[model samples]
Target: LALRSLAFQMSPQELDLGPEKVPGPVWGALFETHDAGAPFSLLVLHDGTAHLYLSTGGGLIGSHGLSEVSQASQRFMTQANRLHHQARPSQDHPLPAAGMSSFYFLTYQGVLCYTAPEARLGDGHDQLSPLFHLARGVVAALESAHHHQSRHTPPAR
Candidate 1:
C-alpha cells in the first residue's frame, strides 16, 4: 500500500462529491490533515458512511450504525453545519500543504472550504477545532473496529 498508489482515493472528487453535485443543506464533510509527512483524510457523510484514507496506504470504508463511529460522525456533522456559514465557497479542490489542514463541507448550495495551520486546529485555537476533534474520534472508532476485526478473523491461507 504505497502512498502514491492511494493518492486518487484522497480527494473530494474521487469520493463522488463536488460543489456542482451536492444540493440543499450541509450533508457531509471531508477533513484533511497535511502536516504528517503524508496527507490523511476522513470523509464523513450524514448517513453514517465514513471513509478514512491513511498516509500509509489502503483505507477503511464502513457504514456506522449504532456504533461509536456513528456517534462521532453525527457530532462532527452537527458542528460542521453550524460552522459552514463561516466557510467560503470553494472554487477549486486543493490539498493543503504541510503544516496545514483543510475542511470541505458539502452543502446544497455548494462546497465550502476552510483551511488553517494544523497546530491551530489541533490546539483548539480555531473555531473549527471542535470539528477537528470530533473527526479524530471518528478515526479512533474506525481504527478500533479494524483492530477488533483483524484480531478475530482467521489469517489468509
Candidate 2:
C-alpha cells in the first residue's frame, strides 16, 4: 500500500448525494427501490480523489475490495444492529454521530475507513487534515489544483 501524508487544501465539487446514483452496470443494482431510501450510498470522484456518502437510517458499509469489504461490513453491520437495539425515540440525536448510529466504512485510496455522520462531524474548518487523511489522495489532488493557474473549483456552501 502507498502511504502518503495528506496535506494542503483546495476547494472541491460538492457531492450529490441525491439518491442511489452510483454509475456502471455492475454498480447500478446497488440501488434497489427504497420506499424511504434507508440503505444507500453516494460515490463521488474528482480527478484522482474520491469519497463516498452513505445514506441510511442504519447503514454501515464499505468497499475495500470485495473480500475485505465483505469481512468489514459484517462487523460494521453488527455494530449498527446493536445500536438499533438500543434506540429510543427522542429529539436528542435521533442518530449517533460516531462509533455507532449511522456510520460508513469506506476505503478511499485503499485506506480502510469508518466515518461518523457528516452532519454531526462538526464543521469542516478544523477537519481538513482528518478529511484529507480519510481520503488519502484528496489533499494532494486538491493542493495540485490550488497551485494551478486555471480555474479552481469553488468550495461548498
Compare the candidates by TM-score and give the number of the best one: 1
The ten-residue window of minimal lDDT in model 1 covers 1-10
Candidate 2 residue-wise lDDT, 54-148, digit = tens:
34332222233333333333333333323322222222212232322222222111112233434333334322223322332322233333345
Name the regions of candidate 1 deviating beyond 4 angstroms: 1-24
Name the best candidate (by lDDT). 1
Q: Residue 117, candidate 2: how far off, in angstroms?
A: 10
Could you tell me how far off, in angstroms, the CA of residue 69 lies in candidate 2 after the best superposition? 1.0
Give the C-alpha miss distance for residue 90 in model 2, angstroms.
8.0
Compose the digit string of candidate 1's lDDT tens values, residues 1-157.
Answer: 2432243334435656454554426777888886359888888876566778776766786645637778778788888878888789986767788998888887765678999988998999999888888888888888888788789999899
Alpha-carbon runs more than 4 Å astray in model 2: 1-51, 54-65, 89-157
TM-scores, one per candidate? 0.80, 0.22
Candidate 1 lands at a TM-score of: 0.80
> lDDT values of the candidates?
0.75, 0.26
